[model samples]
Target: MCSYGSKLVAPWTIASPISAKICRLRQVAKRFYNFGSKEYKSAFGDAPFFDSQGLRERTIQYIKNFDASIWHKDPIRTIVKGNYFIQGVESDTTNAIGNINGKQIFADKETFEKITAHISSSALRYEVSKCKDLMKAVRRLEADLL
Candidate 1:
């Protein structure tokens, strides 16, 4: 995701190699702050990954230890904002992809129950078969989840 944001900042016409480098560094830093730390671990809990505040501390230390040039350019805010936007875009894209994949899986009535268990209500379950759009299906699913 950081790499994606870095690539987007390019072709600014006035951007230099140093500027690009800083942009990449800022993107990396934002990821560390956003999702790669103990804060993230505490917020999300452990499962696939181990619980290690040391690892998070080390990551923060590494970013803090970078050359002043990384902070001199101070592209963190822009990169963070761009990262947020990209996350939304990626989320929407994945939702669309899920809808595409689900169409095949939900082709049958019985299968819809398995899928709906996580996201659909009794009313939604009754009406979902009549839903003609992915967004409507998603909304029904979300309503059930809530």
Candidate 2:
């Protein structure tokens, strides 16, 4: 165990199981996302803003053509609406957005468009607009998804 000033200095250095797991997770995520890589720069940029080729147009068209009635019967609409209630409201990052999976929601143009097409703005307003905590999340998601 590496130590300094009476405290362990390398808990994640394969000595502590818990620390090693956490550190390994971070390593895998950082390597997979390559968040600082120039390849990431070729993507939609650091933020979730739709800055890709023809992506912004597709998102807009999807939102504009999205049918709000789709929320009335489908069980999944509830899921996306639930996401709006907490997404950006709790923080700048989220694990999901509507039917959008946070893990790969932005992976490709098709998935991104599908997510935008499924989001229910009215249901979101009904559920989240009244709550201060959720409104921020709603706003952020709306801006990105819409």
The candidate that achieves the highest TM-score relative to the unseen native structure: 2
User: What is the lDDT of every predicted structure here?
Assistant: 0.44, 0.50
For candidate 1, which ten residues in a row score worst on lDDT? Answer: 84-93
Predicted candidate 2: what Cα RMSD to the true structure?
A: 18.7
lDDT of 2: 0.50
**Per-residue lDDT of candidate 2, residues 63-112 (tens digit):** 99987554433323113434432121111223345453222112245544
lDDT of 2 at 106: 21
Q: Per-residue alpha-carbon lDDT of model 1 for 1-146, expressed as tens digits?
A: 22433354343342477666766788677666656567655544344755689889998998888664433233222121122111111111123446311111112343344445533335436344553434555655555444
- Candidate 1 C-alpha error for residue 20, in Å: 4.0
Model 2: runs farther than 4 Å from truth?
A: 1-15, 43-67, 71-146
